[model samples]
Target: MPLQPLLALTNSEPEEVECPAPAPAPSRPLTAEEYFSEQPPEGDIGRPRHLATKVQKFKATLWLCEDYPLQLQEQIMPILDLMASMSSPHFAKLKDFIQMQLPAGFPVKIEIPLFHVLNARITFGNIFGTETPVPHVQSIEEGDRISAVIDDACFAIPPGYKDATALDDRHCGLDDEEGLLQYAIQQSLMESGTQDDQVDVWEALRGARPVTPSPRSASPNLLNSEERQLQRAIEASLASLSVGPQQAAPAPPPIEDDLQAALALSAQEHSRLESELMEEQRALDEAIRLSLLDK
Candidate 1:
């Protein structure tokens, strides 16, 4: 049996049936192959999107202290970030933060009072790339402070802040024998009577240059008044010997009586005797007078 539509009192004929459009088709979920194969969507292409990686160049300051407990490399990253945020004028104010961060129990007896700030400029192809040598890191003198770089690291240490062990490790004591010898030679050379020639030996022995004695330390070998007089007298005696006409030749050693008898003197000695010659001449003259008378 067909069912009749119910109508309202004032409503016209039964409301015409409203037909809905067919439902839209559902989208297919993307498969792995489709997602991977899809090309990137194009947009405005005025400039290239991929840029060359920037070359990293930056300056950093590092420090080394004698009693500083922490390795400087550990502090660099944080200190760098904090300092970079402030204006250039604010760097001096950061020293307090630096002092606070140092490890406790560090023996900081001789605080050199100033930080050695090693300013380093570094460049990199990548943060972990090979480290190339810096072209030239200028040496800057900032008031009582200086900065320097030593192979792989650049850092500063205070002027008087020597490592506690440096003296202990390197020192060797004074040389006893050498010291005593040097002292003796120095004493001898300093005496007033040391000769000028001896001065050279003393100086050579002590590894010193020959120098003229100062008035304060004049050598004793220099002639004083009395010494000068003695020197003059000796010089005069030598001169007298050299100047004498027919100075007697040095006498030979005396001949022993037994040796003299073995080698008797020749007639040459008799002729040289003045007494013997006079006797012979007188006898010859007497004979000549007697002969004349006889004639």
Candidate 2:
């Protein structure tokens, strides 16, 4: 009986279990340094120059993401962080920024990195929740016509910045930064056109004609290093535009002789019509006279 007890056997089979690949260590968000170090992502040939640009680019991607694609949600984090970081410097330089005395059309040349408008909204939503007032816009035409206002709590916040401190409302003698920002945007949009002369720039770029390299133009040496740098940047951009891939060279301005010929032909046609009308009037008069005589 003791020898037979050892013959008992179990039918258990080995099974392989795959556990979610350990979630890949919850990869960390790219820090600001790592992000800026790379050449900005494609389609952002020129670096982002405004706070509204993220809202512009991500508005379609953001707003409400309850069921949005995982890809878009993944894309928003770095952008959001970068926006939060960039926002601080703008606030830090508020005194100096205001002093720049930027033209009403400042948006045309300058960019507004005012604050992370979406981040502010998200933060507000999390805190104030449904109490957060969404604008009651009853009308909208363009899908891009989204508008978000930064609440009073968000003004000049030094988010993602430590060395930078926020300017106090009473201390700075200003609580109307929102008004100031809106005024600036409105004035600039009105004075400089919707994109602040961006359309003009595209028009300039797509001139429908070839551009020849111009000789270096003279500039004031009196300009400070910063001004000189800015001037060089403008010149470089213009130079690039000048050398942009050539298309048909504006169909060679109609030859002066040809323009004159066209004008002459038009004038001749006008004269002939006038003469024909006069002749018809005379013929009608003659017919009326003959009819009366016959009567």
**Candidate 2, residue 171: lDDT:** 22
Pick the lDDT winner: 1
- CA lDDT, candidate 1, residue 238: 46
Candidate 2 off by > 4 Å: 1-255
Q: What lDDT would each prediction earn against the true structure?
A: 0.38, 0.36
Predicted structure 1: lDDT: 0.38
Model 2, position 62, has a per-residue lDDT of 17
Give residue 290's error in model 2 in angstroms: 0.8
lDDT string, candidate 2, 1-295, tens digits:
0111111122223444433332243244555775688565333232232322111221111132332212222543455456555565433333233233332321111223333342212211221123355443222224534333445655554676532122223222223545434333433344344523332343466764323321111112322432333334434434554664763222222333432233334334445767999999999999999999999
Error of 1 at 161 (Å): 32
> Which 10 consecutive positions of candidate 2 have the poorest summed lDDT?
1-10
Number of clashing pairs per prediction, in order: 3, 0
